[model samples]
Target chain A: MKRNGITIGLIILLIGTAVTAAGIGAMHISPQQVIAILLKQINIHIPVTYDEGMANVLWQIRLPRVIAAILIGSGLAVAGAAMQGLFRNPMADPTLIGISFGASFFAVLTIVVLSSLPFMNGALIPKYYLLNVTTFAGACFTSFVVFRLSKTGGRSLITTLLLSGLAINALCRALTDLVTYVANDEQLRSATYWTMGSLGGVTWSSVWALLPFILVPIILLPRLAKSLNVFALGEQEAAYLGVKVKRLKAVIVVLTTLLVGASVAIAGVIGFVGLIVPHMLRSITGSDHRSLLPNCALLGATLLTMADVVSRTIIAPAELPIGIVTAVIGTPIFVVLLVKQKKQLRLMS
Target chain B: MIITAQNISYSVGQKPILHNLSFAMHPGEVTVVLGPNGAGKSTLLRILSGEQAPSSGTILLNDKSIQTFSLTQLARCRAVLSQQYMLNLPFCCEEIVMMGRYPHFNNHPAAIDRDIVQQCMQEMQVAQFTGRLYQTLSGGEQQRVQMARVLAQLREANAGDVTGKLLLLDEPTASLDCLHQQACLQKARDLAQHGYTVAVILHDLNLAAQFADKIILLKNGQLVKEGSMREVLQPDCIADAYEMEVEVWQHPDYNFPVLVPAEHKVRSILKTSNKNNIHEYNSRSFVKG
Candidate 1:
């Protein structure tokens, strides 16, 4: 019952934060105006403009960016939560499975090499398509490699995964650097910025395209919360409790890859959200995944949306990258968690 | 109900672990498996828990083949606590115990599930640790918490049918001190008395003798002897299984077997004698005796 109350409060906070974020851009719209605009678009009676400038700002620009933040945040956070559970390591992030390296490598390649191709130079391929396709492919490939390398004697070990992620990440980074060395000045700048991550370029089409990839896992993975809680007990206990260990790992890995891969494809490489959000939620929720996961998803969305709002408003007219805002906010929060955990450990001892 | 394994064989790579092993665990009995470290005690528990398949064997649980039962159905019948469980998580004691309800909680845990967890915690004397983090507890406390978790699993199974409760514990008391060890074994014995089939892998022969109704002694992955505690826990059999000289004596007050190293008395005498010659003779006698 308390959990229900918390969930309801979080929902209200998320809605309020998202609406405020949508209103605080260069347009200087009010919160009421933002709601009226949304309601009128949905066919509810409201006094709001469907004017081209306002419509473009609300629907084409701010709306997609807000939705992108929510989706990417929720996706990364859920992926992080699942990865932590899968690895049974609190420090594990979404990239522990090699998704970030994969996405960054592909994004760099598209920016440096593929975009320089004659047919892909300017006219034919949409900039978003080029970025999304390359990033998705890169993420998929690296995930496959990492997953395969971690399996030894037909079983996966947590150590193997950590080591493999390190090896694959290094390899991807090296390759990306190799591409960067030969790239033109324009390509280098774009590649560097893309690697840092941004939600500014998000469009309605990109949001729609990435929806299923993120939404399916968001819907399916939470149902496995009970199993994951059992899994956190250790592999043998999970198997003894009737969980199919290999199958569960596979499902979680594939789903994490899909969600994170699509998230990276749309929003570039947003780091730390996945790692920090879930860890924060686990402390409050008390390690029950059923509660922890949904809470992480909501909190992640809230954090990212708030981060996006800050990214837009902090510098006013000139936007900060969403990734920078997350890092700036997430680092201190992570340190606080570590210190709190240490203090709690001392108390327990 | 009886769990029967026919010619069960297990191998890791090319080396055999359990060679044509056969055993039956009957309901309402405390069955203790005694062995040295590499004698496949944990492997046998794993096989019985369905965590691993025997290389060649058919295991029957109450006339139904083990493979025929769905994973959930098998889990409903059995709960296994392995020798080593290190979770990289700082789960609270109650949450860790609640994991035992996973098989039974296809949806959210019902009122009955929570009650069983609470009852098990009370029985194992871990109720006070419910809100404490599991890793922060002492080794003995952690073992008791794990026992509570296993008891919760058994109770959950019992809720559906009292007859299907089977508890498999591997070295459940290894981390425990003498007092808690006795409590854990007594709990297992109590579960057996309630008509549940309880199989425990124990290194302490004395504890096994005190708790087990039937004891199976294993040597080199083979069943060397199986019978009632008195029949199987002879000094010779235990010495052979452990590859160490041991003296088994009947406890005057408890009517259970107690084991002491055969050389303990001799070693004590040599320490007090202050004579090198006597010490050498006693060392020789200790091995030869």
Candidate 2:
């Protein structure tokens, strides 16, 4: 109950950020109008009325993006926490080891590599949905392969995970380079856009499709907090403490892949939120997965939603890419965190 | 129910770690495993804890194969504390201790789990540091904290089932101060006296002499000696297994065999060899404590 206080605070902050984010973008709506439209769409009819145009902008345009932002932010953060826990390394993140880019690579492969081979066909996916499909495939496949390589002596070894992660990362980079070598300008442009990361192009379908990933992590990862806690004692220590470590490894691999894969797909490979949010929350919430996982998800949602709000509104009508906003905001904060966390890093490693 | 490890042979690639080692741990005694580094003390501990299976042997617990016991059942019967735990997260000391209660929590942490944790912390003398970050603690303090965690895990096992309860620790006192080291091993000794099967791997032959009821000496992954401490800690056996001459004597206070490393023999041998040319060897770091 005491630990839940931090989680509850983060939840409140996320809700406030989500609400405020909905009112941002080119077509400005009052916070009240945003809430009314959202409530009406969800069948909670509000007494307050608003224009249909505002409803279109709120329900159809801005709402999907906001939901996706929240989902992706939390998804990435939770995935990062799980990865860090799985490896027992604080420095572990989806982006650093290239799990985030794994998804981006798949998207590139689908768009650039797969489409180029003879008899491969003109398109792997429809032009509109190309980014989402490819990225998701990339994230899932790379993570699965990398984690499977983590097995040593019938147990998952952190060294194996790190080494395999490096191998997959290099393979993805090489393949992506090859893809770039043969791509036409339009294909390169799209590939480049996806790789640089963005929260743009989030349709209602994108929101709905990512719901399973977002929800699965939020629900499932917290349940694994205790197991992850034991795992922090090292894999053998976890087993000694009665943790089903081999099974826990599989669950961690699956959950992390689902969360990171879906988030990368929805948001085009945003970085740092996964790394920074969990590290920061661990400092506050104290690495108890029970508290840290949910709290990371909440803070992640709030931070990224706020970043999206800034990305759209900082330049007003002309928008900065959401990925750039997070990177800009995230990198400086990450440096500060790493500096503050230096002692812990040194001692543990 | 005792653990019977027979003809246990473990190897990695072409290098053998443990070779045809056979041992049976009886229920009411403390077994201390001692050897030089890389002599497979940790490998043997890992095998007994079921963290690893012997490459070419069988380990039976209570006459049943070790693998036959589910992790939950195995956890209830035994707990292990390894030499080092790499932790980067800034977990509070209490939370770190609470991780020991994980197996007992079942679906959720029951009310009594906190009491168990608190008792173990007090027993380990780490109750005062419960609020600090584990990373902020001194190495000795952290080791004690983890000892508390392992002790808490053992506390969860059924006390009435003495033979079924086992505690395995590997160099648990390696980072501890002398006082804490005695306290930690004394706790294990007390637990063993209460009929729990206890096994430990320790580098300090002196501590093993003081507290270990049964001493199993290993060298080159083979069992060189096994018996009561007095029987196994003979000067010749100690010299052979450890590659150091030790003068064994009964402790005046505790009446246990005390192994005094023959530091004089080494210096005397060096002096005889290089009486006039001892300048270079004497100035080197090896001869100092």
Candidate 3:
């Protein structure tokens, strides 16, 4: 009952933020006018006043960016929750484990190298699909490599998992830098913008492209909430309690890869949203994934949209990177949590 | 239900853990597997619980092959309490116990499931800690909560039909206090009295003597003896299995055998060190004077 109330409250918060954020940029439309414009699209006329310029900005630019923020935020967060549960470690996140770096490396390669190939211009597939597909492949590959590297005698040790994450993160970052060093002026600017993460480039096509990857995982992940709870006991114990541990691991790996890959391909590497959102929700919801997952979706969307609003307006005419804001906020909280986690682990042992 | 193992053998890569072990765990009895470290007792329990398949042989539960039962179906009838649990999340004690009923429900648990969870927590004396975080509890408290979890798993067979229910506990009392250790084994005895087949692995021979209706002694990945307590808890059988001398005595107030390590044969050896100082050490027979 308490979980339901929180869920409903988060939904209202998310809607409130999205509508208000839509009206904050350039033309400054009011919340009432935002709704009026939305209703007008559905063929319902309202008495409120809005010009063609404001409507175009609201419809084409602001709405897609806001929706993209929601999807990307929700995707990264749900994937983080699932990954942490699967690994049975609170510190596990898609970005922390180098999955985002892998996607970024592949996406950068497509932008700089693949698009420049003479045959690529005449290829049947667009660069957009090619980049997304390769990014997804890279994410899947890196996650599996990390998983395989950490597993010893059928069990994955937390120490080895984090160590491997560090190694892979460094390796992918080096490779992305190498690609960036060789890029032309135009490609370099795009790659630089991508690494910092922004929803400014998002359009209707990008939102549509991201929908299946984000929405499918959000809907399907909660279905495994019961099993994930059992998973908290330990992998072997979960199997003893009737969860097919192998199948569960495979499903989480694939689903989280899809989610993180899509988010990275669309908005570049947005770190810490995945890690922080779920960590905050776990304290309130008490780590029951049934509540934790859905709450993560709603709260993650609201928080990221709010962050986007702050990034857009904080510097005025010149926008700040959303990743910088999240990092500045997330780093202190993450360090404090890490210190607390170390104490908890010491107490447990 | 009677779980029968036929010539079960298990190996990991090139090293074998269990060799041609055959046994049947009958309902209404407490069967204890006793062995020293690395004696394959844990592997045997894993095989019987269907967590691992034997390298060669088969296990039958209720006259049907274990492989035929789906994971969910197996969970409804059989529950296992392993030696180590990796739960670091801040789940309430009731939530941890409620996980036992995951197989019995979908999405949300029913009222009966909640009732069983509460009843099991009460049985394990952890009802008062229902809202406390599991990670904040002591090791013994966590073990008791896990005990309640497994009890809730098999609570469906608690009332009328008790057949086909089996409980496997691997060192369930390892982290418990002395009083709780006895209480835990007593709870297993009570479950056996109510028609649940209980199989436990215990390192304490005296505790096994007091609670086990039947005992299986394993040595070097093979069964050394399988019979009643008196037949399997003999001094020679235990000494041979553990490579230590022991004596069995009758309990003063109970009808169970009491085990004491033989200490009378200890010999003190004195040796001159390089510095010309004398060093004295007792042999392995030195338990207590």
Candidate 4:
């Protein structure tokens, strides 16, 4: 009963927080006006004209950014949660498998090299499509390489996986730098901003493009909650409980790659959403993936939306990257969590 | 019903771990696999649990090939507890134990699942810790919780008909203290008595002697001896397997074998008066013979 109450409370809190965040951006729309604007846009007979400037701000500028933040945040957070479960390490994040570095490297390659290709420069091909495809392909390839290199006799050792991730991340970063060094000024600046991460480039088209990769995994991953619970016990125990440990690991890795790859392609390499959101929710939800996954998703959405709101308003007209705002906000909270966890451990001892 | 392994062989890297190992476990009896460290106890358990495939030969479950069964079907027949389990996230005790309902919860757990989990916790004396974080528990308490988790798995597997439930415990008591160790072994014995097939890998010969209805002794990954506890736990066989000198005597109260190191007993006796020491030593030697 208490657990049910907490779940319900968290849901309410998340909805309330998202709504408030959506209302409080730089234009300073009232909550009533925000609701009125939404209702009018939805064809409800409201007194509001959906004020042209506010409508464009809400729908074109803020709404897509909000949705992108929510999707990318939830994707990264749940990916981190599942990765932590799969690797059985608290510190494990989606990037532990090198997906982010791979995505960055490929995104740089596309922006610097592929866009310049003579045939590709033709009017026939869309720029974003080519970039997204290349980035996703590269991310998948690097993750697969990391996965294969970490396997020993058909089983993955956690230590080997961590080391392999570090190695692959370094290699990908080096290649990415090499690409950046040779690029022209404009390409270098774009590559640099992409690495730092922003939702400023998010469009309705980008959201639509990422929908399948992002939503499919989100919908499917929760189905594996029970299996992930069993997995938390250790691989041998999970297998004995009739879990196909190797198969489950493979599916999780692939799905995580998909989610992270999509997020990176859309928002660039947003750092702390994946690492911080899951850890925060784990403390509240008590680590059953059934509960943890959903809560992490909602909390992640709420957090990123709020971060986007701050990034947009904190400096008035000049916007800071959403990624910088998230890190600035997330680091202190992360340190607090770490210290609290240590204290909790001491108390338990 | 009988589960048989025929000429099973496994290797890790270049070194052979299990070589032509063969054994059978029968229902209505506790079959304990006894061996020292690196004797392939865990490897054998993994094979038996269907977690790992043996390099050669086959395991027949009730005269049917184990490979023929789906993972869920195999899970319905057997549950395993291994020595180490770590969670990157802290799980509440009830949540951790409730995971055992995974195989049975094709969709989601019902009230029956909660009841079974609660019952298992009660049985394992872990009910008090149900709301506590699993990581917060002491080593022994954690082991008991794991035992509860397995018991919940067994309960879920046997929810409808209660047949073919095999509990495979690999070094379940290694990290447990004396009280919890006895509790674990007794629980295994009780489960077997209630008609489940129980196979346990035990490191302590005395615990094996106390609870094992039958013992299979392995050395260098091969079955060295197999029989009733009395037949397999003989001092000579144990010494050969462990490379240690030991004496086994019947317990004064239970009549089960009690093992004592020969050197320690000798040291205690030699500290006594010189005159009576010879007499005591001779009498001890007589007892050994």
Candidate 5:
């Protein structure tokens, strides 16, 4: 009952933030006007004195960005939660596991290689969708390679997994840099903007694209909640308790890859949203993935919406990248938690 | 139902850990695997539970190859408790115990499932810690919780109907107190009496002598003795397996074997080697001494 209440509270909070975020951007529309305009879209026009330009900016510019933030935030957070549970480590995130870097490397490659290819000029395909597919494949391939590298005598060790992630992250970064040298001016700008991460330039089309990635995982991951809880007991024990260990690992690896890859393709490589949101919710939810996953989706949506509001308004006119704002906010929380953990260890010892 | 292993062996690189081990666990008996350190007791348990495959051999469950059984199918038939239990996440104690019901996740645990979790936690003396974080429990308390988890798994497997089932425990009583140790082994015996097959790896010969219907002695990855009480309780084979001289005698009150180290007993198994019956000589000499 208490768990349900907390989740409900998070959902309310996310909705409240969404409304406030949409209202506060370039044109300072009131919350009442925001709701009035939103209702007008569905043919329930409320009689209110609102400027046409205010309504247009609210609908076109801010609403898509708000929806994009919710999806990106929710996707990154749930992916982080699942990865941490699968790895049986509190600090594990998709970024730490090299999924994000692999996506970044592949995204950069698509941008550079497509620019030189003559077919890209002919517009045979929507180039953005092609980039998304390539990123997804690259992230999945990275996971496969890392899994193979860490297997010793047919058993995959989580101890070796961390070192493998570090090595792969470094290798992918170097390769991305080496390929960046071959790009022309226009392609270089696209690659640079993508690697830096943003939710700007969003449209209703991007929100449509983000839906399958976020909703599929949101629906699928919670079904594994019980299995993931069993996993907390240790892999061998989990298998003994009827969790098909191999299949569980594969599903988690692929799901997280899809989520991180899609988020990267849509909003570039946003850091710290995955790390910060899930860890904060884990303490409150007590690590049961049933409660943990849903709460992560709500709170991750709320947090990044609030962060987007801050990033766009802090310096006014010239907006900071959403990635920079998240790190600036997340680093202090991480440091404080670390110090508290150290103190607890000292007391325990 | 029967769990039968034939010519099972395991090796790490070139070093052999278990060799040509074969055994059939029977219903209505507690079969305790007794051995010293590095005797492949846990390895054998792992193989029997279908967690680890043997390097070269076959294990059959009810006349079917174990390799053919899916993990969920194998979980529906057997439950295991290993030595090490580690979880970095801070799950509550009840949640930890409830994890044993994973195989039934899709079916949605009913009231009976909730009742089993509570009952097992109470039996293991961990009911008060249900709200406490599992990581905060002491080692012994955590061991009891894990035992409850193992029991919950077995109870869930038998929820459909009680039949001959397999229970493999690796030192389940290692970190337990005297009260819990007796309680745990007694529970194993109670289940065994109800046609559940029980296998345990025990360090205490006295406990095995007290509860086990049959005992298997292992030494250096090889079976030294496998039989009923009288066949394997001989002090000679135990001394060879454990590499320490010991004396065994029937308890004066209960008539079951009572073990005392040679260094602790006077003229213990030393002057009585030539006796016609060691039990008879020991009873006379021990009582007289």
Candidate 6:
């Protein structure tokens, strides 16, 4: 009953935040105007007074960006939650473990290398698809390597895992920087803006294109919540309780790669939504993954939408990077979590 | 169910852990595996639980080769409680207990699953803290919760008969206190009486004497003896397995035998003892049991 209440509350909060965020931009649309515009588009005509261009701005600029934020935010959070459960470590996150960097690295590499190729002139293989495929590969590769390196004996040493993540993040960051060094002017501008991770680039077409990739994982990961809950019992213990451990791990890697990879491909590298959202919700929901996962999706979407709104309005004329806003808030929380659990971390070692 | 391990041998690379051991665990009997450290008791239990495959042998569960059974099939009948659990997530005890019911349900747990989890938690005496996070429990309390979880795993919805189920426990009493240790072994004994095939790996010789209907004594990864408690818990067999001298005495108020370390050697050594003689006594001076 409590889980249901939390779920319903988060859903309502998400809708409220999305509407409010949609109304927030340089050319402001009121909340009532935003609702009227949304309802009118859905064929529910309502009498309201609003500027003709205000409706255009809401539809063309703000709404897609908000929807994109919701999709990417939920995608990253669910992936992070599943990774934390899969690794049996609370500190696991896509950004922390270099998955986002890996995706960004391959994405930049594709733009720099394939953009000038001879066959790239025509749509032999769409550049968008080629970029996504390479980014997914990158995410999967880094995740597998980090996981394999961090496991000593049968247990995952938490210190080793997190340290290895740091190492991989450094390596991917260096490689991404190298790719950016050689890019053309327009490509460089896009890549640089993407690396900072803004929702500024999302269009109706791009949102539709990114939809299936992100939606597949966001929809499917929750179905594995029961198995992931069993996974918290350790790998061998989970197996003893009849979970197909190998298959579950494989599916998680693929789904999370698809999730983080697609989101990074779209939004560059948004950090900490994956980490802090799940971490906060776990305190409220107690890490059951059934309630934890759905609540993560709803709250993650709400928080990132609100963050985007703040990023837009805080500087007014020029906007801050969405990643910068998240990082500013997330860094202190991350440090606080680390400081509070210093003893627990030592005990784990 | 009768689980027969035929010519079981296990090795990690060139180092063998178990070698050419054959045994059968029967329903309605508490068979305890006893030996010193590194005797491969946990390894043997793991193999029998179908978590690990023997290097050169086959395990037959009721005349069917264990490899033929899927993981879900084996899990429905057999549950293992290993010595170390690597869980640190702050899931509540009820949620942790519900994990044992994973194999029996698809997505949502049914009423019968909840009932069984409740009953098992009550039986293991962990129901009082069902809402507490599992990570916050004491070591012994955690062990009891884990015990309840495995019990919930093998529990059938129909409640009474447990004929084909197998429960394997490795060093279950390591973190437990005196009363809980006895309570844990007593619960295994009770489950055995209810027709579950119960096998445990224990380091305590006296606890084995008190609860084990049958004993499998192992030494250097080889079985030294396998028989009833009276036949297998003798001083010589235990001393051969552990390489320590012991005196077997009949308990004054009980029918079971009690093993006491022979202090006569220590007394004599102390009587005339220099540091050199004390070292000699510990090294090789005592008579082999």
lDDT of 3 by residue, A229-279 (tens): 889898878987899999999999999999988888888888898889999
Candidate 4 lDDT by residue in tens digits, A1-349: 6657776877787667666766676676666667788887678866654467887787776677777888888888888888878877666665656778888789888888865676766442256666667777887888788778878976567678878889988998899889999998978978877777888778777777777878898998998888888888877778777888879988898888888888888777777777788887777767888878877777787788878878878896877887788778777876787688789768756
* Model 1: per-residue Cα lDDT over B81-137, one tens digit each: 887776766689998888888788777888888998899999999999978888788
Evaluation by TM-score, superior candidate among 1 and 2 = 1
Query: What fraction of native interface contacts is shared by candidate 3?
Result: 0.79
Stretches of candidate 5 above 4 Å error?
A118-125, A148-160, A340-349, B12-15, B105-107, B156-161, B264-281, B285-289
Candidates' DockQ values? 0.56, 0.53, 0.66, 0.65, 0.72, 0.57
Clashing residue pairs in candidate 1 (N, C-alpha, C atoms within 3 angstroms): none
Rank list by DockQ? 5, 3, 4, 6, 1, 2
| Model 2 CA lDDT for position B140 | 82
Interface RMSD list for the candidates: 1.7, 1.7, 1.0, 1.6, 1.5, 1.7
Model 1 chain B poorest ten-residue lDDT run: B279-288
Candidate 2 collision pairs: A103-A139, A107-A134
TM-score of chain B of 4: 0.89
For model 3, what is the error of residue A284's alpha carbon versus the real structure, in angstroms, after optimal superposition?
0.6
Residue B145 of candidate 2: its Cα lDDT? 90
Model 2 over residues A209-299: C-alpha lDDT tens digits? 7888679768988898888988887888888878888799788877887787777666667888888998888767688888788888889
Expressed as tens digits, the lDDT of each residue in A168-243 for candidate 6 is 9999888878888888887788787667888877888668767888888888888989889988887878778777
The number of the candidate with the highest DockQ is: 5
lDDT tens digits, residue span B1-289, model 4: 4789999999977899999977888878999999888899889988887778998889988888889989988876688887877665788999888878778777678889999999999999999997899888887888889889888887843345657778899889988989889988999998887778899998888899899999988888988898999888765787789887566666344657677676677456444445444334423422332
Listed per prediction, chain B TM-scores read 0.88, 0.88, 0.90, 0.89, 0.92, 0.90
| lDDT tens readout by residue for model 1, A1-349 | 8777877887888899889888778786778878888887678867655455775688778898888888888899998998888877776675655678778888888777776777776543266666666776787788778768877875457678878889987887788788888998988877766667788777788787778878899999998888888888777888878888889988887788777778877776788898888887766667778887888889889999998888878898888888888888878877887797678668656
lDDT for B89 (candidate 6): 68
Off by over 4 Å in 3: A118-125, B264-289
Model 5 agreement with the true structure over B249-277: per-residue lDDT tens digits: 76466757777777666555565565356
